[model samples]
Target chain A: MTAKISPELPERLVAAALAALERGEDVGLRALARDTGVSAMAPYRHFRDKDALLAAVAMRGFADLRDQLLAANAAPDPREALVAQGQAYLAFARARPALFRLMFAGHDGGPPPIEDNAYGVMVRRVRELAPVSLEAATLACWSAVHGMATLALDGGLSPDGSSVEHAALKMIVAGISAAKRS
Target chain B: MTAKISPELPERLVAAALAALERGEDVGLRALARDTGVSAMAPYRHFRDKDALLAAVAMRGFADLRDQLLAANAAPDPREALVAQGQAYLAFARARPALFRLMFAGHDGGPPPIEDNAYGVMVRRVRELAPVSLEAATLACWSAVHGMATLALDGGLSPDGSSVEHAALKMIVAGISAAKRS
Candidate 1:
């Protein structure tokens, strides 16, 4: 749009968009371009439309989550590590509700499948435990945590309330045992 | 904005909006009003804004899901009924992906929590079965099923191709059994 304000226009666009999403603000290309201190039409050069820009933001979200998941492996015990992973997932969701929603809302084509993303790390963790029914264990653990993450965000869980870690620990243990039984 | 042509303009607006959403098209007030064959501003009278309209649609979604859950209770056995409920949940999501997403996506202040909505029905059903740990069982079954529904929508599950219904059934059955053990 003008003399390139920054060579990293694409990166800056997505970063600003992510910040907007995290702040519970709408992400529009024009708004993003302005936020990034770029020319009004600068975003259009990198992203086809608003949808494309949102997709890039979600991609960055998954990358952020991947790091968090990997970092959650701070325990020596596999079980503790598994539980930590669950907590990390929920914590990520709570900390960045809008961005987290964007990641799974299919808002921009459902965030692309990243090979080193959180889900991939989760599957590997489950396999290490060697449950009787890997499919059942994996789905059960993932779904249960995913559900709670969303539920927690909505404050939709029982009014009595419990921590995500406390709740996730119970479900993960139950789900893993269920697989073991199978 | 034209003079009211019909008394049911609000209902018609939501219906048209729901239709637009289910068809994988974006919902816009002006577009919805046009689609409903009403005045360009007719939707504004019923809903303060686009978010309000989306929230209303989500409310309708929960009500619809409640009915389906009840209908799924045709089975006499409680355990069978539980599995039936899980299947019904996924069926509802598959049949109405947009509304299903709307139900949980928290559109425009999110949908109001209905007393007789699907989640309430789910809690009641789970309590009736009397699981070992009500909270844990509820979270596990709900999360597992919720996970499967969203995962199936995104095709985010294991590539081996187990159907969402199949995976949900296993986790639900196992969850209930675990509760029974507790």
Candidate 2:
């Protein structure tokens, strides 16, 4: 009998894990099985264990975010690029709050096995665009945008009350943009 | 049977939880019980559940942070105050990474209820000292410092082996201070 590989298996598995996370719960093997359209034991045969599955899920989240960031920054205008990136950041946080939480929740069973992860890609992009040191640009861009998303999602800033987060994003983008003038 | 009161109960429980977090773990109740010298089940009586205890832990974290922010802003010199606040923010993030995470982690149970509990105090202080709108000052100061801290902790900017976190904090502080100046 020829062993057939399931092309949708990985995608379905990750989707399930992310869905569980979206509900603000842990995504162990059983949960993943339930979330996906496959048999419970089917994931075990593929992923080895929960940690392996989680690692894969985390990588998928990062990759998805990276793609989103790239798309947002693909705007023709540099100014629009920044705003697009900020809006994309907010959208990602709002859309996948749990996955967003997982990305930085810092649950390091070990350093992610993958080299040059999502953060590496983000930092590289910032360095490519700005004259500042890689670290400076990365810190400037990530901190401002990440901080806004975090506060908004974590209730540090109100989303419904005052448009405070919206205003903050504009100011932060302005502040970072003003860096070039300096 | 007489109802027992452990005056030291709250502090001990909090210390245990914070230590578990600082040590880098999920911080379950069993560990807290051992660390706090209470029965494993004891905390449930004092706190409705793990989430309740975590909420208290987050509250204490914010209170301590507020005290530090107040000290920073109270510096005799204006510029010095800015630096102090930024330094204090960094210190808080480093000293209590787990509690810091809990403050904004938005865990499965729910986000810690400390947002309305303590953020108002900090915003009120920012409004009094800075000429900007309360929303502006709050976002300017909070996002600037918080942004820098997140970058440092996530290893996004420090990959080059320099403490770019410190630099980022300085830049954010400068940015906010400059805002105040203009």
Candidate 3:
């Protein structure tokens, strides 16, 4: 019976959890196990607890977000690429609000590490624009983009299309460049 | 019996709800009534439901936030005043994480009207600086400041003092100004 257990159980659990989040249902290990048609105890084999399972789901969320950012980074002009990335960030948040919220819920006093994820992608582009003040510029760009994503999620932003988002991103990019020159 | 009811019951209930949130407890009307030592049905007289009660608390949060922004806006330099406002926004979010989240949770589509709240305060400052593209500039500034505050709460931001936040706010201000010039 042990040998019969599928090696893909972990992936299936994660997929089920993602689906649960998409449906706005609370994701618990036991609930995921039931959703995945596994024994209640089966999930414990892969995840130490619910937090670990949710962390895996968040990891997958980050990976998907990174892919979106990478695709958005294809513009030839560095500034255009950066703006595209910001747009992609907002789109992802709007498309997967539950997952986006979970991704940044901040366990242990901070979000999961970002060096190898979407942050890294945006940071590289910002470095190209503001080499002199890389840290501040990167943080500024991220704060503006992330803020826009959050505000959109909570409906703090106007529903007047992406014009405001577009303009805001351009301002941050331009601001960083100008500050660097000065 | 109606005359025996305390006129301040509603205020007491709101205070109890605020206390519950501060202690990281879920704010249910019944629970708040219990905490306030009132009959369960008594709360219903003042609040139609839990959301109504919570909305009142969120309103108080906004009022407190607006006051902080107002106080921060007293700097003599327009630029410095704006930066101080951003700092105050971040401080408010950090000081009251639960209340801050509740305040922006957005019901019926958008956050409570912003024209008469903290947003109105910031928008006035942004208008003073970037009068040309007033709408875009205002959104950009709000997004940056709000983003920094949210990130700080979720541990997405580094805990390295306020330098990064300061720089980010400055970059946004400069960015809006540069965009206006060009």
Candidate 4:
């Protein structure tokens, strides 16, 4: 009876992993367990190993990014939508550089195993916004926003410094809009 | 008899380090020496240790980036100049991701050590074009361009197996131009 009451172990495991990421875990099962205040052995029940746990965390991060993109895309104006998306992307990176690093950091298991992850949702968002071929539009939008966000996360662009990220993001929005218009 | 023909040993050592970086040697002086065709004992003659060698490599990357920016800024028109600068920046990243990584790998050494390197040149190029505060203009331009370069390097923006670096770069230039006009 006690074991059955724990219930929905996968979601709990994912949640615990994400919380660990937010708290600055280094994308390892050991760190995740440490961050979650759980026994390292506990994660094994839900995930096969460290790779499985990382995949789950990556999936969650992608979902979070996709949701943020969707919300921003639904904004009243196209320009505002783009700006909000850029800001949202940057905010996520700043709030979770550790996870952000894992999302792009080298993976030993070949091409990222991110199927059906946030990338698809992101592409869908781009498709909804621009009528161009999904390939061109996704590449265009992703490069612009991702590039802007990466710079912000690294020391290249500082929000607190005189060279604030807001101005750059505004230009990114304007640029995307102008490109679409042309 | 043996001291005859080599140019400045420091220059040769720095050149060896850069060459190692160019060949995509992963970080560490031993790997660099192997890539540079220098003896294992060679680097120590110029750099006090591996850290100093890495600093030289990073400094060189910045210097190269700065030179490219200056060349781009010298283009005839503002629009042309921006595009040129953007292209140059992207090209540098593509040509040297390993060195690029070393320059921003978050070492304990403060950025101030490398601030006067290529990054300074990039900031100065921005200062030359904008009427506003140099710090602000520099940040805006750096964020946009550096952001784009980073995404390109990380494969974050790849879609449909296409390289959209140039297209995204055009948007960045457009954004910077619009900001300047405003």
Candidate 5:
């Protein structure tokens, strides 16, 4: 049992941390260890501090986000796929506001290197359309979707089912396609 | 002299609150009253609680943001003016991140009624180009700019003067124009 449980300690601690954040409670290393039914020192062995544990939780968030994006990317049309991805992104943020905020927090010195995660999913779809100005198009798309999600979380956008968000996503895709032409 | 000084007490307390937020300190009514050299109970004359004081500070932030938007709207070309307005919005978020976050926080139940503030300023510009789809166009434009500002604050965008941000703004404007044509 020690052999089986010892290797799973890190995963258990991270799960506890994620649960804490989901419930809108401040997470700490000691609290996580207690919640995970482990010696306080056990968490320290797996994670240097609370930041390390939070980082692990954030990674899980990114992976979950990427999966949603992948599922949303199944549309036959490239443009529709992008819009679906945006909707998926918004849904993820809304469903996990605390985790979403935590995932993007404290990315020091530069943009978070999210290329291997959800961003790469967005990039692949963006590249299919705006290959020439790929970087700008991708940034614009991400900014709009992220902004919508952030606003939704902050009560800056309507809480009800928003046709407004749908139309805005279409306008962004149309705008990028227009830019390509010009 | 008492009459003159008494009226300015709320403003002085608000200034103190703003200062504390700027310095990245948690603010309290007692602390703000102390900072303003007022008796602790004196604040209750103007503000019911800390939330009321913070609300005043957020109001001041919105007014300041409107002023910046008004300044940025002075460009000769309408599209140029909109892009400039977005840059100013981003600049405001970066300059006063804590205050910016506070301005948008706890706006429960629905989107904050910002029609009289910065949102009104952007709506006027968006009206010029997309008169038909005004609601959707305005939301898209606001979402894009707001997202960019939020991203810049969260280090999701590069810290150094981002050409990507500029290019993204241009694409959004261009996209809205294309939507209008269609």
Candidate 6:
């Protein structure tokens, strides 16, 4: 057979893409292959094209998010866990704006179903918090959290530079509580 | 002399741009001029370039938003007015998504300042209700609203086909009340 087998080539390529994103440089397939210490063609074997490559990178983002939210969910204090999850969402965006954008970015072919992705983690957490199927309330809470992340990345949050996550969480808690009120 | 003194040229062009956006057609100065029934060069005189034109369009958007919020602010009941304003924000987004997107779209040159823009209107309304400079609270509220709108447009608000506004408003009310509690 071949000289040897390594960890999945696709996973390695996605990891390289993440590293490239962190470095604040362009992440073409060529660069990714080199970063992985593989031949330029190595990425092509795993990915159909740039779109496929980006899609793979987005999967990793979801996995990371799932891990963060699950850890947050484990917190003994329910309220603290909710806030923790919200904070983790913001932290992910701040730490890796490129990946965050890619995770949510619309594609020409439309986004893959979120049912089994990181979104599932969010849905499960929301259901646990809501208990009832107050879908609107859930949507509203999600919107608030998403908006803060977007505002921060787009410079919409005031530059007074206070704690963005704290502000965002307060709003989320309020939205959820208000939904329950009504 | 001009056949008739129409609304000012820039105003006419901005209107044309809005119309073009509604049709989901590409919006270039040339297309706008043609749609507005003006000479191709007419818009150029009023705008430095496409960016300038987009800035003008965004200004118009802010003006419209300001008017809507102002009317909401005049409601007899404070809480009712707050919900009314939030509803108006959603209605504006739903009715004019393209204009709304343009209002927030990133520009390489950086977006124009929000002095006396739709944001100022939001800040004024928020301050009137809060009576304190809890900037973080304000940001949280805004983020939530923005996120909901984005999710709805991007198809991330779940596929339940319920009243998005109802869900969104409940959360907003809760957030405001909670902020007051703190």
True contacts kept of each: 0.37, 0.37, 0.69, 0.37, 0.74, 0.71
> What fraction of the true interface contacts does model 5 reproduce?
0.74
User: Could you give the CAPRI-style class of model 1?
Assistant: acceptable
Better candidate number, 1 or 3, judged by lDDT: 3
Find the candidate with the highest DockQ and give its number: 3
Q: Kindly list the per-residue Cα lDDT of model 6 for residues A1-182, writing each as its tens digit.
A: 44347879888888888988888776898888887878787678777788888977877787787787776667765456667777777777788888877776644354642424456556555665565535666666667777777777776655445465675586666556445433
Q: Which ranges of candidate 3 are over 4 A from the true structure?
A: A1-7, A26-31, A39-45, A109-115, B1-7, B26-30, B39-45, B107-110, B113-115
Off-target runs (Cα >4 Å) in candidate 6 are: A1-60, A71-74, A112-117, A159-164, A178-182, B1-16, B28-49, B110-117, B158-164, B180-182
Alpha carbon lDDT of residue B62, candidate 3? 87
Q: lDDT (0-100) at residue A49 of candidate 2? A: 73
Q: Which DockQ-derived CAPRI band holds candidate 3?
A: medium
Q: Give lDDT for model 3.
A: 0.81
Q: What C-alpha lDDT values do all the predictions have?
A: 0.71, 0.65, 0.81, 0.62, 0.81, 0.68
Worst 10 residues of 1 chain B by lDDT: B159-168
CAPRI-style class, candidate 5:
medium
| Clashing pairs in model 1, backbone N/Cα/C closer than 3 A | A143-B143, B132-B179
Tens-digit lDDT track of model 2 for A80-114: 56657767877898888877766765545624322
**Greater-TM-score candidate between 2 and 5:** 5
Candidate structures ordered by lDDT, highest first? 3, 5, 1, 6, 2, 4
Write down the worst ten-residue block by lDDT for model 1 chain A. Answer: A107-116
**lDDT (10s digit) by residue, model 4, range A1-182:** 23443556667777776776777644566666665556678779877777666766776777777777666666766556666776777778788887776665544342352334445645554555555444544555555556556555656554564235556556655555566632
**DockQ, Cα level, model 4:** 0.30
- Give lDDT: candidate 3, residue B182: 21
On a 0 to 100 scale, what is the lDDT of residue B62 in model 1? 83
TM-score of 3: 0.88
Worst 10 residues of 5 chain B by lDDT: B106-115
